[model samples]
Target: MTDQHAPVVVAARRTWIGTVGRGHHERTETDLAAAVLAATACDLRGLGNDTPTDDVVLGSCTGPGGNVARAAALAAGLGVGVPGLTVDRQCGSGLAAVIAAAQQVRAGDARLVLAGGTESASRAPQRAHRAPHGLTPYARAAFTPAPWADPDMGAAADALARRRGITRERQDAYAVRSHTLARAAHAAGRFGPESVPVGDRLDRDERARRLDPDVVGRLRAAFTPDGTVTAATASPVSDGAAVVAVVPESVRRDLRVPGLRVVATASVGCDPALPGWGPVPATRAVLDRAGWSVADLRAVEIVEAFAAQVLAMTDALGLDPLGGDERVCADGGALALGHPWGATGAVSVVRLFSRLVRAGAPAGARGLATAAVGGGTGVAALVEVVR
Candidate 1:
């Protein structure tokens, strides 16, 4: 019953994620994006000769502020004939780029497309706007007109934890588990196939993998006085890139490439004051559209913006947040691996591809990748392994 013309992911890859200003400091966002895009293109070609890519779409939050997608395509040697586009939907940018490409393929605009996201936090430009009459500069952008209501991420996380009865101890425990799982997955070489070396060094996510419960507990609150939310529970600023090749299912069959059918995508808006809750409704929307329930998913990846937020989401979905199910980010998540802003969502897709496609899961095994965006936006995508 699989639709041969459905959009499918045939290849997926990502640069080794790095902490902000450390691992990929020497490289530009374009450099990171080009590396992943080129690797994906080469992989697609290796699979077959007729897989012509029509466009490249990339999501970026704060780069050099130009059309980074175009720059990356040219840098990847994909030729000027391939058009490019860049999107900025905060944390959802990466997944949104993939969705946009998938829609184009579904509309029969193109047979193949490259889509994903990249972010070089270290190189992100320092932005400022001139005041009236060229007075003082504004250093930050406002997410809402009511400044008092728009809480910083940490404040929102702390509030969510308090309202949801998620204790500081529980958050710390979840962080520890994330690190533990990530280290174990890395030791098992789980990241080898999907990870690409970045810059002049071998690829590795050299973030906070080692965890000491006592140390994490002792860390002071990062955003609010007497708050439970700390740096340990929040996603770190990071740099990286990820890309997936989207082709029709028929093309996948012709090339003998394993297919991960993108069955449905959903995006929704929530209260800008509490952005973390965005994922709940978005995931619900997608599942409803696909006529599937959360329990039906074989694997799931939710951006780890904060442990408290993730805990809330798990409760909403009626799942155990720290149970360490193989279906939920088996290789760890943003808490341990670091969050590369725009690239995090696409990284989730790359993880799904690895879990269901590269690992040869049984046909029809379903997966989900969802994220809560900065401006109270949530995006989710559902995919199924196709034979």
Candidate 2:
């Protein structure tokens, strides 16, 4: 492709995140993804036939082994002819899926694509191996090589917190801020625009209202007896889905879809031991590719798998973590909203979409959405308002 067309996100939407085994406990992963995909497609429908998309690309980590994307596409009534691709790349899967869709558009193989991620922690099947003897419950899947020292995500976060000198107090404070902002945003109806209600009610984020300062301060370490990481500071397991409509810039005018144009994308590998720091390199790489600086971005959304994870990235990137800076997750983050592993990264993109496109921010407003992966990888993308 000589003159590759740039990719742009025209529509974005997400399901109201619900606590695991609560609001969406009965919903399947395919159904959640289909719901969000249908909402996003409906958002595009206003553009008429110009909104036609070529495929559906989805991401998941704990979903059933088969091609969940195909199931979701069919369930969403996207037509049996539309091909679907499913990707699993740990925590970064969602953003990576969006990047993959954008690449297809850039390569001219697709004019429009539906890309995002979904997760149903409540409905995820418990793993167990059948054996001649009694079956043993599976604890977790390997995320890295045996030699790389694979630690459970919570333990890894605790290790990073200790290494970075991030105190338990700091993590708790950050968690409090997340809930405060998220609740305030919710009360102001800020989330209504991007979130779709589910199951006979306008579902709200269950974790956003669970803030208790004294309770958080007294919580014990979740992974280690003396570690800093705790349940209060970590993102809760939740069920939800989020997706975006990606179209080539060539069709933006014809479709009258005003949104963010993709500027650059990056996926970088890092040390598996310190997974929380992955976003630092990922964001830097994307900015370098676009020849832009941190100063160029008006907003940033680095998924908060844990409060310490976000703080570590802020420190590495020279951002003010406690200064009430509006550039970083102005509304809130996963700590308050809950993290549906596979969908968390795409939720960050939806945050950017709401801030840059729906909020009527100044023209050319730029934002970067980035995330750290479980297996020593970081993924990020830089985008700007097309107007």
Candidate 3:
């Protein structure tokens, strides 16, 4: 009963994620995004379709001000006919872009699209407004207006951990598990198929193993005074890009390629003060729309913005396999892979593609990807394997 005209993600790829100021320091968002775009385009063609892409939809946060999607599209040699759009939903930006592209394909407005996200935190220093007296700098952008409180992600995570009763030891244990899984994946070459080398240099993550419990145990709180949340529990500010080719199901049929079929997507709003809870509602909505429950999902990916936040989500969602859930982040998550804010959501999708599609899961096998945004929003997509 699969819809042949529905949009399917046939190819997914990402550049090696790096710590903000170290590996990709000299590369802009455009440079990193363009590399993956080009690689993903090759994937599209290799699947036996050279039809020019209809559009480029990308998401970014704190990138070089202008329209980075358009710039990256041209830089990737997509030609002048293809237009581009950029979306920003804070940390949810990347998944939002993919959902936007799927909407276009569903409406028959476009046949094929490239969608994902990119971020260059190192290159994007704090921006300032042109004041009459001089320049006024702000630490971060405002997500809410008066009356409502919008604390930084670090502080919010600490508060959320305490409110949710997530112990610091549990968070530290999860952190170690993430690194352990990621290292196992890397040693087995699990990342090579989906990861592209950046700048012909080290194409690996820079900050994970430093989180030794003895070491992490001694580290002080990063945001709140006397808080349990520490550097070891939070994802680092990182830089990277990821892209996927979303094509009509007819294309997948024609190419004889197995891919993830876009089934349903949901976005929900929550209290700005507790943005991490956004995923709880968003995931529920998407699953309801798809007529599928957690028990039916073969794989799930949730951005690991913080160990406490991720644990809260898993607990709320009733997913019981907490210690080593192969169904959840079998390879790793942002904790070990590095969360390039805007790009991490798409990276989630890419990981699902690798886990389900590339691994040859049975037809109709389902997977999910979700992310919690800083602006009190959550986005989730339900996809199925079509063989």
Q: What is the TM-score of each candidate against the true structure?
A: 0.97, 0.97, 0.98
Q: In TM-score terms, which candidate is top?
A: 3
* Model 1 alpha-carbon miss at residue 312, Å: 0.8
Clashes in candidate 3: how many? 0
Global lDDT for candidate 3? Answer: 0.89
Question: Candidate 1, which ten residues in sequence have the lowest lDDT sum?
Answer: 134-143
Better of 2 and 3 by lDDT: 3
User: Which parts of model 2 have CA positions greater than 4 angstroms off?
Assistant: 1-4, 49-51, 130-134
- Per-residue CA lDDT of candidate 2, range 109-207, in tens? 999899999999998988888888978789778888778978788888998898888888889989988888899999999999999876854368877
What lDDT, from 0 to 1, does candidate 1 have?
0.88
Ranking of models by lDDT: 3, 1, 2
All models: lDDT? 0.88, 0.87, 0.89
